[model samples]
Target: MSSGIPYTWDTDCIRASATCRAEGRLGKGTKHHPLEIQSTTTKKVVYLSDSGSSSLHTVGERMDWKRLTLVFCWLECASAAGISCRNEQGQAVDWYILYKQPSINDENGLVYLYMDESTGGWVPAHNPIDDQKSALAQTLLPLFQHFTNETINFGYILYNDQPPEPFKTASSSFGHSKGLVMMDQETGIWLSHSTPHFPGFDITGFWPNSGYANGQTFICGTYKYSAFRNIAVQLQYIHVYSFDAYIPEYFYPELQCVVDKGCYPKKTPWDRQLNMTSLGGHSFISYAKYSRYHDDLYSGLLDKHLESAFYAKSWGRLLDPLPSNCSVDFSVYNVETVQLPTTEPYSITKDHSKWCVTMDSKLHRWTCIADMNREVSQEHRGGGAICTDNAAVWSAFLDIVNTYQPCQS
Candidate 1:
């Protein structure tokens, strides 16, 4: 995780990429096996020559769309079944969030509260969190069912701080993040969660045994193909540690780096902010910081940009956690206790989830599900946050801040 070789994006490169997308030069697709990919291994894959190069060619030849009309037709036909976030009933949804409750004395912690645009607030899960027909299972059905098949219409990347067995632990400076990015040539979904060593390279049994203990959170959003390119650029700043990926030739050039487990920043101003719009037109802001940028991601960065005081809940069991800070323009407090409906209050130490919510929902109403903890060790790590101002999402997080540590006198 040492700093990457310096790379720069000039104005010409930006214009070339914009033109490439505008012309729909994304190439033909291919199928891949996730468990077999190695970051160090080089594959004979197609890549757009530096950003300044505009022509899209594969294997040193210009594409003939007329001869490849069949491929285009297949993509259009498959786009109808593109990947997306699903609700508890296995229906496609614009966005959704699940708060898996922790196990108590008589409970096994299988139950969770589900929320989406349709579910005004939070609704009790129809099935257990790990059940096959659950929302997560249904959402991933395409990847699980089609991965081994020869279909080349879709691609996916699974990344996490604590990946499945055999994958070595990421460098301490890498982002403390866990999530999956899946998509077709047309649309896709980005799922951000706080679970570790979960939903591994395997196709079935989406949840792992360790995921049943502590409370966790997941946010899933559906976006068009162009947005995935933006997401790939943001991951470069986050320095994501991707354990498994299947990037077809049809994917945008920005995503090719994921196949090699690369997200090292290419230039100075090692941080980036972007407004990504979902297919349904919901607005979300992504914030990313490279590992070399030393600062507290929440108090020192996000709070001021969001222009609001925050109540943050992160892994409190770690050593040397940052105390609440009020000296800055926007104060950031540490959440101490969380209480959900029908459950007793629990200490933040038992939760490994990382998220922050605006202190005043009436004014800001912002909630961010992010990577990185409010601990001294994570201050130097590369990480990012996905934030939204949707009322339902904002209320769900704000309600969880039952108690927090105020700045000392």
Candidate 2:
């Protein structure tokens, strides 16, 4: 029911591990952001709070609920079981996690995470993924859809010693990173993808140790790829992985596929092409939503919802064909100017995925799993390398957007 300025509410939870599956009691514990603003002007997110603690107990005690609509926060994990270990001294054996790794919503319509197995001392007791109340939300009272949960296998991919041309289907077309799903499916050769989707994750968990903790990016609409952006995200480099990689966050409602109950949620990767015609843009579809994501959609740097890295078919490099040709060209379709990526200060570029808000347009900056770890995110090269000639937005744009609608009871 709350909108404008700052969204305030009463508080938080923790994950059993990196995934959203709550390890401990998903209880109604603490809170974050007495003043949380998703700045419409600067488009830059700014969070102002006096508390710098991960104690859900303490956060809930001091939260002012009249301020915001949602409360987003992060907690540190101790093991694959996602439990923070109390040492012989009855305290969590402290590890230095720097950043507050963000929990994200993604196009898949499922909230996924690969908890870094290195965060805590390996306690062989249990696996956090199945823990009823993950570290996420404390109160185990079934809160319906606070988050969609799923476990992911974040591990290594061995490039075949002998190179083959590329097989389209051989590629992991779903949660794509650029290892090489097959340069040309027709040729059966691998292109060699090196984005975040390739490398394995910690499963133990990362964050809240050495970096800044700003879990405020959890808005109502988005998709979560992997949270390991804080880890190594370089295409040129090998073994690029994440503590957790956060990809395209979607707003649950945008997904148009329906269920037996007659709800139109989106489909997963396996059946994506079979139902390719159903793939469209945001809920606000004025004209045909066209992009390289499919034969029909082509939204180039259109909005926050569309700007993403290259296709999974290629390994994080520019999706081949140099200039992708969307099925609809200017002459055939009734294409009018909706929202242009160039109108906002948002940035964009070749390699990496994130962009900064610029003067006129959203210029994308090349980023990878590494940008999440390093402080300095490099500026993208100008014209030569990066081009959106005939590109499309995210394939799961609608699905990711649908995950956030208040889940039904």
Candidate 3:
């Protein structure tokens, strides 16, 4: 995996395309031949011609051959139906984080910094954050292109605190989280972001105008299909306000309840924690809390679970932001200023991103991207955090903390 390289989109297949339904083969037999085929038959198998022609010659038991083809088609469809996180270059990545800078000092907020496993530190984005070729847009290409596909193989759920037009008001008790989950039966991407009304219900110009003023962050990871079961269960704890969702009726029975209004929890466990593994084998921990929890996310939950002091960065426009606290075993401080490697330092007032990292890199290097803000009102809201201890990810976040407020007492 390398950065600063132009991606060639011509070599890749159209992900989740209904026209490319898994039959015996799926792909245009162009120069390199990206088609994947597997069939058990007595007839001799022939490779697709370089002229982009589908050719097959075989003679055997008619009914048996048809049965074998149908069986293979099912297998092929499952294997070919993949939805993963794509990078700026249109290449698949295990995970990536984007930090969109605040539009201060006569600059548009479209400027952002990008980091992934390959990039040791934050790299200045080559294009505007909302551009089609940017990392976020490329990763969402599948959702934008196939949202209305008639195939039952695709599934998605778009949730946010501030929904799109006609339904902008969100429930006060719902989670403050904002993100979208989209995927096929094989694999999918879980993108957790800190922008309001982003990638809205309508596909036309997904980015919202309100997001241009404050800084925001996005963390995306690709996970296997089975992992969504745990993820779906956790979303219930978060009590997400899903603005738009398309959960296929027959496929992914575990996800059906997510969009089902009747299935929303009334009184159950206030919170839940689950461990998940990405398709690339990276481990992540999801910590979710319901409104019934009635506590601050970082000091009351994360600090105790991880047993490490934290420097949290959250939206600074709150009416009464919680100050740094040293009352707990693991103290939690508020980040006041941020300085990215490629950008000038800015106050938290210009940023709305919610994230935190361990104060000491020696003992604990946990980094979390969450939706909860350190404030009085948010204490009663349902929200959650996704955390990882990956060294690269930790370092990238740790390096951005330029200043923070210490315990006042």
Candidate 4:
């Protein structure tokens, strides 16, 4: 593996991918998938981004809501979604997906950490009256309507996921007003990690929602949620981030690792550490393997929830109907049980065909491309996941991850 890529993958994927390239079917990107964490400080935070140009550019705490209005005016949307990251050259980038404000309600909400004395910026959410979603599609969506060829296949949700009261501080970065916490502007990384990805207000525990050691985990995998074939194309770098803010993935009733801690959830067989996603059907399959706790391998039965956490959130809250100014195709879901062949080997879909979207095994919790349209109908089970499917998005995400793999020394 090369130093540029962030994680490792199953040997079989590596071999088959190598074979594909050898057969003139595909080219290669980074090899080693280096684990990266860009240095962040008062001056800069390399790994996160949001609506504000800077991580500190929030609605108000000690400052004014000037910047939010500015973006609201230009981007023309109130609800929006975004990410903060550094490109390959280590340049900080704030990428956002927003919508034009609706005529009836053009105001985007500022999720302040507090009720008064502070306000986070008004994040953008597309307005169906002007912007496009289903029609325009992701890759087809241009970076700028005014003038730019950059595509928007990856920017999906764009709204303020604020924290609720009793949680508000009024003077903190992402100043508390409602139930919301982006990477704290004061702390550096933009919002989005502290809370689990629940439909509304899942950040009851902390801030920097997806940061390391929050009794949560981050899983990465290519999606098979929408269209099967389109997602499979980007098989090399699918990442599904799972956070256990709700409960540690490895909790067990009989395992001694599960200790009583009334102050917190039971002490796990393992203590607080970062989490990962196996992308395999751990939730659906029994006795699979997984990765967790500073990247250690764990039994799937020990922490099935870790690999299965993504399904806990509702896709309805995160997904927006296709807007006009946008050219992006999206799909994501989860279910309790399944109707798909229990015996069929996991595979990635190709040419509109259904295949198993298996999780990468070599790496602990992992991500990979899989079949999307492949629907194994279930009679009485439920789970969920959200994914954006587009060859362009798949390509763009890989490029973005490669470019944003963080500077790990």
lDDT winner among the candidates? Answer: 3
241 Cα displacement, candidate 2 (Å) = 18
Per-prediction TM-score to the true structure, in the order listed: 0.79, 0.21, 0.81, 0.18
Q: Stretches of candidate 2 above 4 Å error?
A: 1-195, 198-320, 324-328, 331-409
Q: How much lDDT does each candidate structure score?
A: 0.73, 0.20, 0.75, 0.19
lDDT of 1 by residue, 1-409 (tens): 0122111111112222222122232233223211111112221122223332222223436655453333223233223245788765455788888888887763758788888888777888888989866788767766675554535777888888888777877877668788888888778999988888867543356688787767888889999988888899887678788888888886887777855765578678878898989888899998888877788899877976878898988886888899999998999999999987747888876677889999785778899988788988888888888999998888878887789999988
Task: Residues 1-409, candidate 2: write the lDDT tens digits.
Answer: 1223222222232222322233332222212433322222211122433344322122325434442332343222222222221221112221111111222221111112221113321122121222333222121111111122432221112221111222232222112222221101011111122223221222222111211211111101011212122111112122211122222233111111100112211332211110111001112111111111232122222222224322211112233322322321211111111112112111112112221111112443211111111011111110001111111122111111111112123
Model 1 scores a C-alpha lDDT of 0.73
RMSD vs true structure, all candidates: 13.6, 20.8, 8.6, 25.5
Ten-residue region with minimum lDDT total, candidate 3: 3-12
Candidate 4 off by > 4 Å: 1-162, 169-265, 271-396, 405-409
What number of clashing residue pairs does each candidate have, in the order they appear?
Answer: 0, 133, 0, 97
Q: Return whichever of 2 and 3 wins on TM-score.
A: 3
Candidate 4 lDDT tens digits, 166-272 = 23222211110011111211111111222222222211222232222111111122112232122211110111121112212232221111111112122233222
Comparing 2 and 4 by TM-score, which wins? 2
Decide which is better by lDDT, 1 or 3: 3
